[model samples]
Target: MSIVVPVYQGERTLRALIDEILPLTSRTYSPSGRPLVVEEVLLVFDHGPDGSADVIRELVSDHSFVRGVWLSRNFGQHPATLAGMASSGGEWIVTMDEDGQHDPADIGGLLDTALDRQSSVVYAKPTNAAPHGLWRNAASRGSKWLIATAMGADSTVSYQSYRLVLGEVGRSVAAYAGSEAYLDVALGWIAGEVTTSPVELREEHGRRSGYNVRTLLSHFWRMVLSSGTKGLRLVSFIGVAFAILGLVLVLWVLASYLLFDVGTEVQGWASTMVILLFGFGATLFSLGVVAEYVGVNVKTAMGKPPYLIVADPADGPLGRTATRPEPPEHTTPT
Candidate 1:
C-alpha cells in the first residue's frame, strides 16, 4: 500500500503527519493476511502560500520512502491528489489530508473494511463532527446533500478526502478524469464496490483550515458537473413542465374569451402576445442549440476522456491483445 497526501499551506503539520505514518511503514498487515506497508508517502504540493516545498524536500532527503510531487501551480486539492495517485504503484492507495486531522494508524481498519466487504474503495466516515466551526461544517454538509440528491451521485454521497482505493482504480481515474472532475465521482465512474469505515477526525493541532465559502461552492459545482448529465436533465424537465403549465394557462384564457362571445379585444391581444412569445422562444431555442454545441466543445477542451477502463479485459492472454481477426502470428497488431 501507499499513502498520498495533498499538501497546501500545511508546512507546520506535514512533518507531524509523516511522523505518525513512519511507524506503520512495514509493520502492519491487511485483513487479507498480506503484509501491509506504506511503501511510499507521496506529499503532493499544490503550490500554496507556505514553504511546503522546502518541507517536502527535507522529508524526501530524510526518508527514502517519502517522495514529493510538486505541481506547476495551485491546481487545488483534488488535482494534486490525482497527480499523486497517478504516480503511485502500490496495490492499495490511501489518500488523506496533510494536516493531522486524519490518523495514519486507522489505515489498517480501512484496509480491513475493504477486504471484508470486497470493496474497491473505502471512505473514512467521521465518527465525530469535523474539526471546523458550525457554518463551514453546515455548508459542507449542505453541498454534499445537494450534490447527492440533486445531481444523482448518491454512490459517492458519503465521500470524504480520507479514503482507501485500489491502486489500479485510482490510477485509471487520474489518467482519464477531467481537470475539474470531482475525485469521488471519477472513482464512482469505475469502481462500483464502494464502502465506508467509521473514523473520528482529530482536531487540527494549531493548523489553519484553508476552507471557505468560495472553495466549497467551487467544489460543489464541479461535483454537479462531473457526476454526469443529470443536472442538464433536471433543467430540461423543469423547462418542459413550465411550458406545459403555460400552454394550459393559454388554453384557459382562450376558452374564457370565446365563452364571453364579446371578448374580441382580449382575444386579439392574446393572439399578438402569442406571436411575440413564439418569436422569442424561437430565438432562445436557436441560442440554446448553439450553447449545446459550445457545451460539448467545452467538455472536450476540459480533457474529459471519452471512456475509462476499470479493469482488464476478461480471458485476455498475458502481454497480448484480447482478440485478433486472424491467427496470433500476424493478426493482433495494433
Candidate 2:
C-alpha cells in the first residue's frame, strides 16, 4: 500500500503524521489472506509559505520507503494528490490529510471494507462530526449533497480526504484529470464500485485548516463544473418549459381577442416588460453555461498539466540526477 499525502503548510504536523504511519509499515496478511504492507509513503509538496519542502527532504533522506515529489508551486489539494497518485507505484493508494485528522490505524478497516464490498475505492466516512464549526460543517455537507445529486451518486457517499483507492484506478484517473477536475468526481466517473468505511474523526493536531470560506466556495464551484455539464441540460429544460408557457399565453391572448373582442389595450407595457426580462434573463443564463463549457474545453486543448514536479525521489534528493525528458503537458478534458 502507498499512502499519498499532499503537503501544504504542514511543517509541524507532517513529521508526526508520518511517524504514526511508519509503524504500520510492517508486513501482514490482509483479511483476504493476501500479504499486505505499507511499501511507501509519498509526500507531494505544494509550495506553501512554510518549510514543508525541507521537512519532506529530511524525511525522504532518513527513510528509504518515504518518497518525495516537489511541485513547482501550489496547485491546491486535489491536483497535488493527482501528482502523488501518478507517481505512486503500489497496489493500493491511500490518501489522507497532513493535519493528522485521519488515523493511520484505520487503514486496515478501509482495506477490509473495500475487499468485502468488492469496491475500487473506499472513502473513510467520519462517524462523528467534523472538527469544524457548525456553519462550516453544514456548508461542507450541503456541497457534497449537491455534487452527489448532480452526479447521480448515492446520497450516502460521503467524500473525505481519507480514502483508499485501487492503485490502477487512481493512476488512471490521475492521468486524465483536468485542471477543473474534482478528484472525487473524477473517481466517481471511472470507479463503479465505491463504498464508505466508518471512521471516527480525530482532533486536528496543531495545524489550522488550509481552507477558508473563499477557498471552500472555490472548491465547490470547481466540483460543480467538473461533475458534468448537467447545468447546461437543466437550462435547456427550463427553456423548453418557458417556450410551452409562452405558447399557452399566446393562445389565451388570441382566444380573448377573437371571442371577447378584447383590443390591443389589454396587453399592457408591464406585461411586455416582464416577458422581455424573463427571455433576456434565460438567454444570458444559457450563454453563461455555454461559455463555461467552452472555457474548460479551451484549457484542455491548451494542455495544462495537473501538477508539475521539479523533483522526483528516484533522481536523488532534488531530482538532480534525472536523465529523462520532461513529461508531456496534459490535463483532464472538459
Candidate 3:
C-alpha cells in the first residue's frame, strides 16, 4: 500500500506526519484481516518559497519508500495530487493532506473497510473533522452542497483525500486529465463500493492553509465546470423550463387581450419591465454556464496540460523516482 501526500509549505509537520504513518507499516493485518506491507509514500512537494523542497530532499537520502516529486510552481492542490497519484506504485493508494488534520491512525480502518466491503474506494469521512472558523466551516459545507447538487448525493459523501484507493482505480482517476479537476468528483466516477467511515481530524500546528477564499472559490468553479455533464444537464433543464414558462406567459397575455382584457389593460409598464429584466438575467446566466463548457474544450484542444511537473528527482523512499514528461514547445494551437 502507498500513501500519496501532496506537500506544500508544510515545513511544520512533514516529519511528524511521516512518523505517525510508520506505525501503519508495522501492522500485519489491515482492518479487514488482510496482510499489510506498506509499499511506499509518494509525496509531491508543490512549488513554494519555503524550505519544504529542501526538507523533502533530505528525507529522500535515507528512506527508500519516501519518494518526492517537485513541481515548477504551485499548480493548486487537485493538480499536485493528481501528479503524485500518477507516480504511485502500490497495490493500494491513499491520498491525504500533508497537514496533520488527516489522522494516519485511521488508515487501518480505511484499509479494513476497503477489503471487507470489497470497495474500490474506502473514505475517511471526518465525523469529528476539525473545525476551521465558523465561516470557514459554513463555506466548506456550502461547497459540498454545491457539488452534491451538481453531481448526485452519492458523489458528495463528505470524504476528504484521506481515503484508500485500489491501485488500478487510482490510476484510472489520474488518467482523467482536466484543466479543472475536482478530486472528490473524479473519485466518484471510477470508484465503486464507495463507503465512508468516521475518523478524527486535527488542527494545524503552525501555518494556516495557503488556500484563501479566492482560491477556494476558484476551485469550486472548476469543480462544477469540469466535473461532468450533470451540471450542464441541470442548467439545460432550467433553461428549457424558463423558456416554456415565458412562452406560456406570452400566450396568457395575448389571450387576455383578445378575450377578457385583464393584464393587458394594466396601468403602467411595470409588468413588461419586470418580465424583460427577468428574461434577460436568466438568459445571461444560462449563457455563462454554456460558455464554461466551451472554455474547457478550448483548453483541451490547445493541448494545455492540467498541471506541470517541475522538479521530480529519482531515488527516494517510494522507490527510484521516474522522470516527469516534458511539455510541448507550444502550449496552444495557432
Residue-level lDDT of model 3, residues 1-334, one tens digit each, is 8888888877777888888777676656756576787778877888776778777887777577788877667887888888888888889988888878887777778888877788898778786645577787788888788777656656537757688889988877887767566776778777778887778888876778877889878877877876777777877887898889889988987787789846534553887789788878887888888888888888888877767775554334444556778887876767
The candidate with the higher lDDT, 2 or 3, is 2
lDDT of 1: 0.81
Comparison by TM-score, 1 against 3, better one:
3
1-334 per-residue lDDT for model 2 (tens digits): 9999999988998889989988778887654565679999999998888988889888989888998888888899999999999999999999999988999988888999998899999999998999988999999988888766765657878888899999999999999898878899899989969999999998889767888999999898777778787877877887998899899989987888789966556456798899889988988988887888888889888998778887543356654765889999999999
Candidate 1 per-residue lDDT over residues 1-334, each given as its tens digit: 8899998988899989989999888677754565688899998877789888789888989999998776656788888889889889999999999879999888988998988889999999998999899998888888788876777766454889999999999999988787657899889989968989989899997867887778877787777767777766765765676578678878977787778566446446777788668757755765564565457559779775532222211123432754757755646758
Scanning candidate 1 in windows of ten residues, the lowest lDDT window is: 306-315
Could you give me the TM-score of model 3 versus the true structure?
Answer: 0.84
**Which regions of candidate 1 fall more than 4 Å away from where they truly are?**
30-34, 155-157, 255-299, 302-334
What residue runs in model 2 are displaced by over 4 Å at the alpha carbon? 28-35, 251-275, 312-334
lDDT of 2 at 317: 66
The alpha-carbon root-mean-square deviation between model 2 and the true structure, to one decimal in Å, is 10.2
